[model samples]
Target: MKIDATLHYALIFRDMTTEIEASKLVNRLAYEDSLTGIANRTYFIQELENALLEKRSIGVLLLDLNGFKQINDQFGHISGDEVLKTVAMLLTKSFPTPHFAARLGGDEFVVLLDGITRQSQLDESIGFIKTKEKNFSVLLGEQSVPVEFSVGGAYRENGDTIDELLMRADEQMYKEKYKDRPHERNSFN
Candidate 1:
């Protein structure tokens, strides 16, 4: 059977469109966080590795949300999820293009700042994040739950590998996280 030329082209276009949409959905599912809509850990790691391969000056800002478990306990997971989404929105807004944010599971989130040639730029980014921490709070059922967090950042030094960079940043983050906890400090000390 012969088909009309116009109809044949229209069918081809529709098929192409469907394929494109399916590809997009697959990519999103692979590289995006289901809850917060930010880059998933896999995407973040790949991007970081690419930046390192390109020898770009980059910094990693690691953040851990304080009292997140309490929020999950007191307000429940739904409210906790809302808080995570809000934080992701703020991170995306604060660190636009050339910088990437990812949720490294739970209350841990990270930002990869690329093309950072100066310390001031890193300082500026961290300062903005700290400011956000000061003003950040979520309202749940007439109660304001402050979204407090501890952030630590590490700039890539010469000959630094991904693990080394991540470890340094993680160590700094833990230091910041536990600095306020005297009771727990003795165990580590």
Candidate 2:
């Protein structure tokens, strides 16, 4: 009887351990960005949904690298990937913990800032990102290449849906891209 009880307890413990491990794996897959180890788009959307449901005011920033395709075409896909990783690192460092950042795929990233109450604070945060310099170098064979991004954002009050917020941010991002084209061309020369 004693041996049976011991075996039963051991089996229960093993089952519990396995359950915990599986839960952790699911959470990791759901939340982590497979490429850069930042949060993924699913995680970002979940958080944004929660914030909106709770009637929270927030700011969403969408960033797309200008001339990213040029880098991929001129250097190669590997170089493009390195530039993306470096940009992700810069974004994670720039934003705070309560604020979430994620790569929305390709060269575009999204940042969601919760509990924002004022336009000035939002402006300050946007200004901070605009001034950040991504100075990382990617090695293509024996050569080093540099890259940068253009960012734009939109603020949400209490009732905006995810699609609406993303659309506004994307539109603003396109405007910034167009505005920077002159300087972008100049920099290549």
Candidate 3:
């Protein structure tokens, strides 16, 4: 009788441990982008909401990879995936704690700057990202492909909603994307 009781308790503990691990995995999956291992859109939205509620100075930087489709078409999806993973690694490394980076699906990414105290800090951060963006390259087999992207950023202002902030950042990104060709700018609006 004593042996049976001990065995039953051990099994119960094992089951509980398994349940805890499974729950952790589910939570991670919900907040994380599977391919890039970075925060996903859901996580980004939650963080942004918290920042808004706390009344912290916030800056959002949106990035869109240039010629992403062409890379996918020419080198196959495996190489494209490698490029994305490389970029994700770079973003996370470049912008560590307090600053958040997420993949907003496809080749689009976003970074949230929290508790920013000055315009200079924001400008410096943007300059660093731009410099990194210009220098980084991904290795695909024997070929090296440069990572090129258009980035736009906006600082939160009084009476600004999340949608408005995102829209403004997106507009700036579009402007950067079409800067060379003035005629194509009208279609973005």
lDDT of each: 0.88, 0.80, 0.87
For residues 31-119, what per-residue lDDT tens digits would candidate 3 score against the true structure? 99999999999999898887877778998989999989988998999999999999899999999988989999999999998866566
Q: Which lDDT tens digits does candidate 2 get at residues 4-48?
A: 557433343335888899999999888988787788898988988
**lDDT at residue 182 of model 1 (Cα atoms):** 52
* Top model number, lDDT: 1
Candidate 3 has which clashing residue pairs, if any? none
Which regions of candidate 3 are displaced past 4 Å?
1-15, 117-119, 185-189
| Ten contiguous residues with the weakest lDDT in model 1 | 5-14
Q: Give per-residue lDDT, candidate 1, residue 164.
A: 95
lDDT string for model 1 (100-159, tens) is: 899999999999998776667777777889998897898987998899888888878888
TM-scores of all candidate predictions against the true structure: 0.87, 0.80, 0.87
What does the lDDT read for residue 69 in candidate 1? 88
Instruction: In angstroms, give how far residue 27 of model 3 lies from its true place.
Output: 0.8
